[model samples]
Target: MINKKDIKTLIVKKPLTLDCGRVISDFPIAYETYGKLNERKDNAILIFHALTGDQFVTGKNPVTDKDGWWAYAVGSGKAINTDKYFLICANVIGGCMGSFGPSHIDPETKKAFGTKFPVITINDMVNAQVNLLDHFKINQLFSVIGGSMGGMQVLQFVSNFPDKAKTAIPIACTSSHSAQNIAFNELGRQSIMADSDWKEGNYQNQNLNPGKGLSVARMAAHITYLSKKGLENKFGRKLQERDDLKFGFDADFQIESYLRHQGSVFVDRFDANSYLYITRAMDYFDLPRKFGGNLSKAFEKTKTKFFIISFTSDWLYPTQENKDIVIALNSIGADVGFAEIESDKGHDSFLLDVPDFLNVLKNFVDKSYEELIR
Candidate 1:
């Protein structure tokens, strides 16, 4: 079992009020760092992880023994080159990766928080993570970057602290969660809740693993991360093991087996209740609504350079939604750049090894660094 002691964390002693009107302090924000912080501290980049991602962004996760989630795009000489930049990624407060979450014991009852854990929002996540800046003594970050829910955190981070970052990159995400997004997330949550092993989110106390339900949730959500064309190109109608149909529901197709493997492995590393909490946070994200229904207002008084990206095939957070952010920034006469890269991969294009994306991202960050410092 992965324990909190295995991960590095920052214990936040100062109380932080959440959007849900709860105050929490002395909680932990689990994190990992790469590269060295420069004397000026301007090279620091705060990276935010997507829904299931942890603080392990660019190296082998000590706990999972698996490649870090952003291994392809980050590392010594990759796009977000650690050779020239210092990177810090925090496991969001609602995460399971040794961060403050439902799995942690509540001092009052001396039991796991479970469903009693207060509901968090995208705003709450960024608010808690911003403590990292103070902890690291960084007055301003060189950039704030993330994709999907991470991207939402990036938006909230910049909005909440306009002057804290010099540049902001929100990729393959939306300022507002759509109804379709909520529906898909709800499906995953319901699948988990439906499992008897879930035990009403108190399964941790009972020592019953809600693996089946969490696996199903992961499987359902995984489908939304891929595109129709990408799925067809990769799996199509290929058989898993035997070409002949067994007629039973035993994963006859390659896609079924692939999804099953994805789901099963996910439960080994993730907590079921954390999944529920994080999805609710994602579903509640509405940046424009928070800013008086004018997304442009979210960028007011911020000189942070903005570079937004989207994948043409990402129906989950479509290019149009990304364009909406660009349109809003443009309306406010904010300095902004936008790109919609062509890819067969869906919302997951940002995470995969897309050369076009890697190059574009590298060029933007590097060029911005040089120009800013000059």
Candidate 2:
């Protein structure tokens, strides 16, 4: 029940051409800002969110009543240090959170775009962000930071607009989605498509939402976000309530109950079609392929500093994947710092309270800020 006024948005009347040859005119972008821009406007930090994250980065979300996803790491005196920097986050083009997406109405047809929304790539998402930056007159960003899919956007931003950011921070992400990563995305897509209520992605007309399928998709993907050790430590074959096994199909274990709750809660806030579109975009991301099969070439012309990080237990985007990026950066002699934090928290470690990770961020940002001012 989020109205347009509830979130700050910018509407671009100019037609935006997509990578898939589709044009969207007069679209809206939803965003949120923290701190304030200085007179020189050089203290701006652009942050991107993960797959299901919105523009809410450090405040209460009016729509969900939930605290911002990165609230712990971003605030006045936190790692990012909003007191000393201007922080901005925008919902990507294919996001369901007040942004133009499959759930929004098409001015021409007067109905939701749904499946008719053109397939978008990671590049397309970055282009939309560029437009938003233009609207705000932010010629350059102090730094660009993100994790997971957001991390993909960070890589795309640095490659596509080398001069727009002074520094780049991509955590728990791969330059290209691996075959296994693509497989997981495909599995989620199939789960949504298999639901009878999906109705070929036009469920709105039938008044029957694809909640069941979407929930199953979320449940499956949620498992990939956590480490096996973390899961074991959390649930550990514990029962949901009763000590005895029900021996039935019901959720007899704590893990099953936890996943079910995650799925159910997700369906209440996200759109099924948006999920499909965003996942497809991630699967299509291949930085090396985009730049003549030379990942280093993607940053050959740039002088932007880099801070890449990976979690030890993050199988989704393992330390080796991050090292590959470091190798490419080193091959071109690009200024880069890479860290593989030892953690049992898995891919979601970046979002959790990891002291080492926070310290690294604070140190990098502090050093960069001092250098910029000097």
Candidate 3:
């Protein structure tokens, strides 16, 4: 179990600029640190979390008394290897996990920002992270590593601050949100708002939550996180807890029971309004938009080495997305390597116990470290 008493929260009391031409000030960033920061501070690894992730990257969660989400990749001898590298993970802006988000109080109305929170882009999330880094006096990072939405932020960091990181690893991600992706996100948003209890995003004041709506949304989205083969292999037509199906509103299938459990646990740890804000931020992410819609133009000035990894079964952001990032990087002569791991775990493969991917990461980070020193 991780020590909760020592868990500290740092706040940046200033407004920030957003991609939508809006300002967010007096913001507070919540973060957690593991391992000691060496004198040089270059031993630091900045980790960006995905849509529903918090700063509890490793160690047990204080709130729920559960294991950390990514403990598999971030222990003493793990891939992130806490013994050697100082690790930092912060709850991103617009996140529900201790960071300023829709749940945070708005200075203007002194109420929760709710739907009034400005829409943020991946660049904006990176900018908020920059503030957190400044607070910690980390001028540069040894590496920036992330998966899924976190990967989007990683790309944003390398593009915006080319000199800040020596290496970047963006796993199971796209350079930008595709139109189809946006539509899927919108459906989730609509499901949340459609709940009568949502009360135009003011559900917090009434102490009511759109639990059913949020669960439905989660259930729908979680399906995209896996491949058809994975789902089939894991659950298929297996019956749940009964020899024969009742066939009437019962969780007759194993998959249905699993999904219900996912939704229930997710609602406990996450806020509904935050779900809206973060998803919207993800939908607006477009790396090439900053450079006249030319994807290659985005990496023209960067010297950062990139290791882009994708899972063969991850339809959410398939191997093609990784290829596009590599092609663009190559267009500008950027140092880049791409790998597509064969796995049935789909988009969640990176977070799972995959020896092959872990070995690749170990080698990649080690090589980058050697190159930087030489």
Candidate 4:
């Protein structure tokens, strides 16, 4: 059985080559593991988190004092069934939570990397995870599963390491960011850069942070994660503890109050520069482009079984986008499954409590495990 320990942070001493020709050396990766790896080590399942998610996937987050982001879908006997599989989740390198990012210190200058940090792509994040897996001596993964930005990493992992994972699941994401998606990310980045305290991404040096700007950015991005139907169902024209309009800009509506709260809570835990870097990485992600405009070529040699999912209300990554991925996989005769669930939960449905989604996930993992053992 694998020994359980507190969240572990490992420093990769070797230089990591990036697509932009930049290199990162001696960077730290913070991760948390659930369950135990058996003697064979073939039962390992690597889970990649969303854009803002961290290593804490199924337990109490020591830093946030809150339940894990995906507690409902992962854990012993949950959809992922930690009891049957060794689950691992790590903070992506271009992330703020316990991974190498703009918030990390550059050994050369002894200051936060900030804008000075080399630009990273989804592939870079997957490369970091591969290095981490190498550290653990795990040659083949039972499965790789993720949604949203995490799903992007899932795609990257399968494309770059075709023989590494036996099964791959990418949910509510696309191989490349859509024009609308890039516009939304650009808006968030602009919000941070427009903040007066941002100080041109050197706010750390001035002992100031762009809390307000980052908060606004979070508020804006949070809107995209929800569908109009879901938002109306949750907060539809409700007032925020007020009887009527106050005739002022002090959050007269319940939706406004809820969004403000999201923004406020986010700024406390995430770095503005990290937000900038991670969003840029997403905007630059295009698996087909990297493989010379042949999406099928990216997975032609892969033996991995893929299960792709999309939510009906997820406009950020609509069902058509997922269908496109399925088509590409089909073109190459790759083993694949596609599910477009009927849900009003929007792009965030994968992370929320959706019975249908969870059941699908559980069945897929169970079947994959069954095939592995046979």
Best by TM-score: 1
Model 4 scores a C-alpha lDDT of 0.90
lDDT by residue (54-115, candidate 2, tens digit) is 99997688888888999879998999998999988999998898878888887778877889
Where is model 3 more than 4 Å wrong at Cα? 1-7
Clashes of each: 0, 0, 4, 0
Give me the displacement of residue 240 in model 3, in angstroms: 0.6
Pairs with steric clashes in candidate 1: none
Instruction: Between candidates 2 and 3, name the one with more favorable TM-score.
Output: 2
Q: Return the number of clashes found in candidate 3.
A: 4
Give lDDT for model 1.
Answer: 0.94
Q: Which portions of model 4 miss their true places by more than 4 Å?
A: 1-6
Error of 1 at 201 (Å): 0.8
After the best TM-score superposition of candidate 2, give how far the Cα of residue 202 lies from its true spot, in angstroms: 0.7
Where's the lowest-lDDT run of ten residues in candidate 2? 1-10
Residue-level lDDT for 226 in candidate 2: 96
Question: Quick one: RMSD of model 3?
Answer: 2.1
Residue range 41-109, candidate 3, lDDT tens digits: 878889999988888888887866777878888888888888878988988888877777888777779
| 263-325: candidate 4 lDDT, tens digit per residue | 999988888998999999999999999789888999988999999999999999999999999
Write the residue-wise lDDT of candidate 1 on 211-328 in tens digits: 9999999999999999999999999999998969999989999999999999999999999999999999999999999778999998897999999999999999999999999999
TM per prediction: 0.99, 0.98, 0.96, 0.97
What is residue 315's positional error in candidate 1, in angstroms? 0.7
